[model samples]
Target chain A: MAIVAQTSRFSKIAWPVVAWIVGLIFFFPIFYMVMTSFKTDADAVNPEFLFSFTPTLENYANMTDNYDYWRFATNSIITSVFATLFALVVGVPCAYSMAFSPTRSTKDILMWMLSTKMLPAAAVLYPMTFLTKNVLGVFDTHFLVIVVLCLINLPIVVWMLFTYFKDIPKDIIEAGQMDGLNTWGEIKEILIPLAWGGIVSTALLTFIFCWNEAYWTVRLTTIDAATLSKLIEGNRAPEGLFFGRLSAVSTAAVGPIIVLGWFCQKQLVQGLTFGAVK
Target chain B: MANRTIPRILQTPAVILLLIWMLVPLSLTLFYSFIRYVLNSTVRPEWMTPSFSNWRGFGNYEFVLNSKDFWFAVKNSIFIVTSILTLTVVLGVLIAVLINRSFPGRGIVRVLLISPFFVMPAVNAVLWINMLLDPVLGLQGIAVNNINTLIGGLQDAPIVGWFFNMWPVFEPISFRATQTSSIAVIMMVTWQWTPFAVLIFMTSLQSEDQQQKEAAILDGASRWSQFRFLTLPHLGRPMAIVVMIQAIFHLSLYAEIEIVSRGNGNKNLPYLIGEFANNNIGAASATGIFAVILANIVAIFLLRMVGKTLME
Candidate 1:
């Protein structure tokens, strides 16, 4: 009894300290970025200013002159929002059908939809460039970016909503059926209210994915629809000369998305794992 | 009959959209892989455009197969993926188990931990390369210089002077070099993805059978044994899911590789393809096809597992 009590006493003090230390270590890079953003370019690399330096907002102030931060940011916001909306519009109905009234091939269709995601974007870049640039004539436009984002994210949207909707009792939907309600009415009233949290998480997560979607966003656009990802990658501190402004721009690009990510961290598992883990 | 038709009609839009999205470009890649094509050709300019008459049967594939970069890319891809898998899983399991129990500031801990996973890969690569890993100006450089200075000061002390004099000056490693660039990528990517693995494993840990764990404890199983025998087995499926998901995602890791070293010596399959796409359209398409085959092999196992459990 004494030994057990002593071990418990030891663990009570040790565990939280260890956990706090681990958390801080993981968060240090973000802290460093935010801290570096407050310095001038000269102070950014100076070892003497590592801990003690006059903090300045000059980096944030000169963001427009330096990188045209707002143009790319607005593009990112426009594309990500519209893409999320479009995906939800298409995904909700498909997932609803699969969940409430799954046929024999519903499972196969879901699997096949997921397989499309595994088709690498790099493999198809040339064809997409050729089609969009020459044939479609919509290259580097917001509409093209929105459509591409929506298509890539549709499968995960359907899969996440299906998992959420699967948990609702089938009898509830059938109860609406016995009441003579039409299909749209049943979904609007019975299905959606029960799965509202699921729907919101799916949207939020999708928006996050669209925001952080560096690959397609960077490759597809040139100037008009170039996102914050493109802006940051295009100006990667040539010779480490502009670390201060670069950090400011990067922090601005990802800060909102990171905070947004915190709210949907719980749903990331179902979304990324194809609802398989839970 | 009406209900069935409605569901089918509703699903048709999504299905058709995905079908077009998947088929159009892939077929183009497949077609181009067989033909002779280049974006710019000063000599034999007729071959510049993609056409059936210029089909070089398996010539592109042969060139890709024999190139030293292709083989290096294949080996480097395997190495990066395998190293990340090992690191994320091990670190993920440890961190997941550590925080599984209720503790102070758990919410804050989780919030801090998950922040890294959301950073844009472009930002991640740039941040690591410039602010964190640069030899002369990064935090790494500053820390090394500080340590050497401190050791130099110690070398002046009376008793520890001899001990400090024996210690060599610390030299910071430049991560943009050929040999160590891949290690830099592995570090940054592991930093980004370890949180993802933790999230999955933590979710799986919540569903772990508490009663089974208690029984093992009552049977006098030590902590290590209990975790090894019970927790590890219970997490098998989630671990597999994490591994496969990461495999699919990291196989196409381009932004990091592009920003960090520009494939200085750390070229993976995707980077290799990007390099080829500069002028050699045929070779790039063929390599893209090879990447597709590699991704599909992993995707098949994952889809099978997911399909089985999905219906259940």
Candidate 2:
């Protein structure tokens, strides 16, 4: 008993120290990014000022002049927000039907939706470009960006919403139906009310995904509909020269989404896994 | 079922939207793959436009297969994806078990741990390549410089002078170099995803049966035995889910690879496709078809595993 207790005590002390180390190691890059953001570009590269620098906000202040940060940010915000809303508008009804009234093909359909997500975006890049540029003539427009973002994310959005909607009791929706509520009334009044948490979390996760999405968002649009991704890519500042302003802008780009992500950490597991883990 | 008609009607919009979304670009890709398509061709100007007359059956497929870069990209893609998957799952399980028990500041620790996943891939690659792993101007350089400085200082000391003199100067690794850029991508991706693994495994851990665990304890089972017998089995489903979902996502990884090496020498399948799409639409289309086949193979396997549980 004494031996067991001794080992247990040792483990209790050791585990948290290990946990702290792991956490810090994982977070060090982001921490370093934020830290470097305060230094001048010269100081950012200077070895002596690596740890203890006289911090400044000059980079952040010049962000507008430097990167045209707001335009790209607004574009990201506009596209991501509208895209998330559109995905939800499309996803909810689809998911609700599949969850409540699953057909023999419903599972196959859901799996098929998921498989579309695995289609390498680059594989279809030329086709998308050719279509949008030549046939549709909507290249580099905000509408194109919004539609592309919404479509790219639609699969995950539907999958996540399906998983969430599955957890709701069928009796609740049925009871609403029993009360002579129309389908719209049943969805708006009962289903949405009950699945509000799921919908909100799905939206939050979808928004994070949309904001962080890089491949299509970067490739599909140029100047007219360029989001923050294009800004970061265009101004990547190779060779670590502009660590100060680069860090500032990178932080600016990912900061809000990361904070928003903090709120939806739990839901992230469900969203990422399509609720398989949960 | 009056309610059923309305529900099905409501679903029509989403279904139709996704159907078009999936079919249009894909059919175009299919069409282009079979045709001798090129964005620009001076000798044969008509070949520039996609038409049935331009069709060259299996020619593009042969072009991609014979290309050295395509094979290299396929191998590198598999290498990077497999390495990340293995690292994440192993680390994820260990860390999940380690932090599964109640501990002080566990919530805060989890929050801190999961921070990387939220970071944009572009920012993640930039942060790692510049700040953390830069050979000369980044933390790696600073740390190496500090160590060398410390060694130099010690070399002047009387007793430790001989020992310090014996030590060779350390060199910081340049991750941007050809062979190591994949390592950088793997490192950044692993860091970002281990938390995801931990999150899933931990969730599954919470559902682990305490009574069964206690029973094993009373039966004089060792901790390793108990974990092996009970906990590992419990984690099987989550592990599969993590691997399957990650396989799907990482198989198509692009931005990280693009941002890290700029498709220099470390090109994956998707990157290769992008490279060919510059002018050789035929080769790009064939590569796209191959990518689709690869994805379908994995998708069929994964969907089969989770299919039953998903429906129920």
Candidate 3:
């Protein structure tokens, strides 16, 4: 009994310490980046001033002059917001109908949508470039970025909305129908109010995805519609020369999305796994 | 009749959009793969445009298959995906279990852990390669130098001098090299994604049956046995979900590979495709088709698992 008691007591202190250590280790790089942002370029790479450097806002202040940070940031905001709105607009109705009155083929259709997500974007890279640049002449436009982002994220949005909608009892929708509400009225009045939480989270997750999207946003845009991802990729080979300013810009690019991510960590599992795990 | 028709109408726009999104570009790729095409070929200017007149049948596929880089990219892709999947799952399970219990600052711990998942892949790559892994100015270099300095000091001591003298000087690794670039990609991606796996596993853990665990304790089952039998089985479904979802995402890993080494020593199928697309449209299209085929094989199994859970 004493042996068991001693071991249990030892574990009680050890567990939390271990957990905190692991968490700090994982977070150290971001913490270091943020810390480095306050140093000058010289101090950033200097070994002597590794941790004791005088902090300055020069990196953040000179960001615009150095990188044209605002232009790219504005582009990121415009595309991600519109894409999220568009995906929800298309996704909600599809998920609503499928949830309320799923037919035999509903399952297959849902699976097919997900399968489309699995199609490697690299394979279609040339075709998309050719079509947009040559045929449609819409390359590097905000509209093109929005449409591509929306299309890529539409499947996840629908799947998330479907799972959320499935949780609401069908009796509510049926009652709305019996009240002489048409499909549109049922969705607008009843379903929307009930699944409001789910919709917001889905939109939030989709927005985060659009913001962090690196491939299409980077590949498709050159200057006009390029997001923060493009800006960072363009300056990728800094070779430690501009670590301070680079960290500042990179921090700016991902800071808001990381904060936003905290709120929807719960929804992320459902969003990414299609609610299969839960 | 009206009921089914309205539901179908609601679904039509989404279905049709996805269909067009999937088919048009892909069909173009398929068409291009069968033809002789190049963006710039002064010797064969006729081959520059995509047309049936430049039909090459299976020749492009043959070319991609015969290329040495194509095989290396395929092998490297498999190696990277599997390494990341293995590391994330192992580390994820341990961390999830570690924090699963109530502890001081648990909420803060979780937020910190998950922050990496939200970092843009480009930022993740740059931060790791230049700021953390650079052999000269990175933290790795600084830390290694400090340790070697410490060892040098210890070598002047009396009894510990012999031991310190035997210690080798620590040298920082350059992750930008061809051999280590893929490893860098795997490291950064694993750091970014372990949080995702941890979050899912922790959620699944919350739903585990406490009654079974208590009963196992009453039967004198050790901690390992209880976890192995009860918790491990409970985690099986979540584990599968993690593996499949990650496999799909990491198989097409691009920004990380590009930013890490610029495909210097590390090139995956997507990188290889991007390279080919620079000039050889036919070979690029053929490689793209192969990438699609690879993704589909993984997708089919994932879809089957997801379908089983659907409509339930």
Candidate 4:
């Protein structure tokens, strides 16, 4: 009894402390980046002022003049928002059909869509560039980035919507149909409200992905319509200085998404795991 | 069930979009692969433009197969993917278990733990390679230098002075080196993705049979045995899901590798393909086909598992 009591008491303290320490350790790098952002570039690399430097807003202040930060920031916002909207616009109807009225090949179609995602972007890199640059002439344009983002995320968007739509009872939709509602009406008036939470979270996750997408956005864009990902990748080799400005830009790039992510951590698991775990 | 037309119409747009997205570029790649295409060949400029006249059946494939770089890239891609998979899963399980129980500030802990997942890959690579893993300029360098200075000062102490003097000076390790570049990629990717694995495993943990766990406790099972026997078995499916999901992501990892060392000695298949595309379009296309095959091989298992999820 004493041993059990002692072990229980020990664990009661041990587990929480361990969890907190691990959490802090994991968060330290991000914290360091944010902290470094407030230092001047010179002080950023100086060990003498490591933890005691005078924090400044000089880096963020000169962001636009120094790196053309706003252009990239605007491009990121435009592409991500439009891509998320387009994906949902296309995905909802497809998921609705699969959920409410699955056909003989619905399962196959869903699997096939997921399979498309597994297609490596690199495999078609040359062709995509060739087609966009020479044939289609949409290279480095917002239209191209938006379309690419929507296409790549469309499968996951559809899958997420399908999973959410599956949870709604068919009887509800049938009743709505009996009440003289068409398919569009059913989706807008009935299905959406029922799955509003799922749809919003899906959009959030997709937007986050489009924002963080480094591969196509980098490869397709040179100067026009480049994103924050392109900004950081271009400036990857800072040559020992510019750490302050770099951190500021990175913080700006990821700050909104991380906060958004904190709100939807639960949905993230459900979406990424394909509702399999639950 | 009532009518197939509208449903098919609704799905048609999606189908057609993906079909074009998948087929058009890929077919172009396939066509280019069969031709002896190159961007700049002063000796044989006729090979510049892709044409039927330049058709070289099986030649590009044979060239790719014979290349030593191709084998190194395949080996490295597999190594990076497997290393990252093992690290994320093991660390995910441990961290998920650690924070499973209700505790003080669990919400904040969860926030901090999961923050890394939201970091952009570009930022993750830049932050790690420049600010954290840099041998002379990063935090690791500064910390290592601090320890050495501390040791140097300690050499004057009375009792431990001799021990301190005997201790060798420490040197900070550079991750940008040929051999260690992939290790940097692995570390940063694991940091970003362990949170993902943790989130999935935590969700899975929540759905575990509490009553069965209690029964094990009543039957006098140790914590380790209870975890080993009951929890591990329950987590089997989620582990597989984590492994395959990560495999899908890490197989084509680019920004991280590019930023880390420009694929110096740690070239993966995708990096190899990128290198070839700079001049040798035919070789690039052939390598892309190989990558597609490799991807499909990993993806088949995941498709089966996900399809079954819906069937249930």
Chain B TM-score, model 4, reads 0.97
Give the winner by lDDT: 3
Give the C-alpha lDDT of model 4: 0.93
- Candidate 4 lDDT, tens digit per residue, B79-150? 999999999999999999999889999999999999999999999999999999888889999999999999
Q: Per-residue error at B256 for model 3, in Å? A: 0.6
lDDT tens digits, residue span A148-239, model 3: 99999999999999999999998899988889999889999999999999999999999999999999999999999999999999999998
DockQ for the candidate 3 complex? 0.71
Which residue pairs show collisions in model 1?
none
Ranked by DockQ, top first = 3, 4, 1, 2
Runs in model 4 lying further than 4 Å from the true structure = A1-7
Instruction: Identify the runs in model 1 with alpha carbons over 4 angstroms from their true place.
Output: A1-7, B263-265
Residue-level lDDT tens digits of model 1 in B35-65: 9999998998988999999999999999999
After superposing candidate 3 on the true structure, give the runs of residues whose Cα lies further than 4 Å from its correct spot: A1-7
Q: Taking the tens digit of each residue's C-alpha lDDT, what string does model 2 give over A1-278?
A: 42244357678799889987888888888898999999999999998787898999999999998889999999999999999999999898899889888877788788888777778787788999988988999998889888988988898898888888888988888899889897778889998989899899999998998898898888889987899888888765467778899999999998898889889988888777776676
lDDT of 1: 0.91
User: Per-residue lDDT for B227-311 in model 2, tens only?
Assistant: 8999999999898888888887888898888888784688999899898999999889889989988888888877777676687
Query: How would the docking of model 1 be graded?
Result: medium
Write candidate 3's Cα lDDT for B71-141 as tens digits: 99999999999999999999998998899988889999999999999999999999999999999999999
Q: Which residue pairs clash within candidate 3?
A: B178-B265
Task: Give the Cα RMSD of candidate 2.
Answer: 1.9
